[model samples]
Target: MTESNTITCEKFLPHHPAAVWKALTDPDLHARWWAAGDIRPVVGHRFTLDMGNFGSQPCEVTEVHDQRILAYRFAETTLNTTITWTLNPEGEGTRLVLTHTDFDLDSPMGRQAYDGMGRGWPHVLDRLEGVLGETPGFDEEP
Candidate 1:
């Protein structure tokens, strides 16, 4: 079977960019959507995302455009991939993009991860939108 080199998922969240930004940065809020990590937007910041049974994956912030984009080197010792999250204001909400790239498909681990993550990311994004929807005072323009 052919393995994937990257896992990309996009979703339109019915909340403002600020709200989605908060969900991406805040650990408590982020845990509700994705893995728990001290994921800040500042470049060079290092953190670990708890990938449940997959263990903690080390990550470093590689790029940041404030609330617009956040990219990082993910699972350096394992999957050795990069995960980027982009947020764009669209209509009355936010357009969120998740790109997981550089999977070493030649390796067994990579093939497993590529298959799993490809199926998993959509659920992750959906949960992100759900979390933001339930959050209070996240999208208000006050």
Candidate 2:
């Protein structure tokens, strides 16, 4: 679902939260699924994601709850938005929810990003699931 200032995408992955969390935090694995960056689970850590043609985006870790939650300020200057990942254990798999909020819909850049990301997040999550399927032991119970 997408709102004016927020885009939320949820997917059920047939993998453990630990595995899903690893894909979210591990730089190598993360790069394979999403953008490349020195992404860590530690709060206050700063990094930049190589967004292909969009250039590099600055991000700062704002919150981390182990495998449960990870929130960060994304595109600090240009977008000035927050991207949050939430993991919920469901059945034998994990329910991953991504919430991207704080878009300045009034601005041209913000509106464009909001529209683009709204359509892009699902594909990104699909890539994440594919990566998990390929990783050894990632699809197995921990």
Candidate 3:
């Protein structure tokens, strides 16, 4: 485990950065691939996505830099994590970067959390990619 770790997931989407950003920020669009519905990107706004018996995580959107970055605080932590999306224009597509950082991953509890995120992010991102192309996918199923 390492402190201040970064897990970056990249994808090439055949769409505009604004469109992708919309999907990342808009509640309706975000719910399609990040939770069990109910998500928004307004700063200081708190929302929850049902995780069944695993408990729902209430998250707050702390900061948003338009199409550049989105940061949020999870659960009861005073510390906040960020997901930076750098949209690089590459020919007829856009290169999307999803970076999650600002968490201590060296401790036992932190390690467990980081491990879970490490496994979860791929599937989440995959669903995101799928939804970008098709209209029949979800991060946690509909």
Candidate achieving the largest lDDT: 2
Per-model TM against the reference:
0.94, 0.97, 0.75
Q: What TM-score does candidate 2 reach? A: 0.97
lDDT of 2 by residue, 8-33 (tens): 99999999999999999999999999
Clashing pairs in 1: none
TM match of model 3 to true structure:
0.75
Please give the lDDT score at residue 43 for candidate 1.
Answer: 95
Candidate 3 Cα deviation (angstroms), residue 98: 1.4
Clashing pairs in 3: none
Model 1 Cα shift for residue 123 (angstroms): 0.4
| Tens digits of lDDT, candidate 3, 75-107 | 434224555666775665678877877656656
lDDT of 1 by residue, 56-131 (tens): 9999999999789989999999888998989989998888989999998888999888899899899888888888
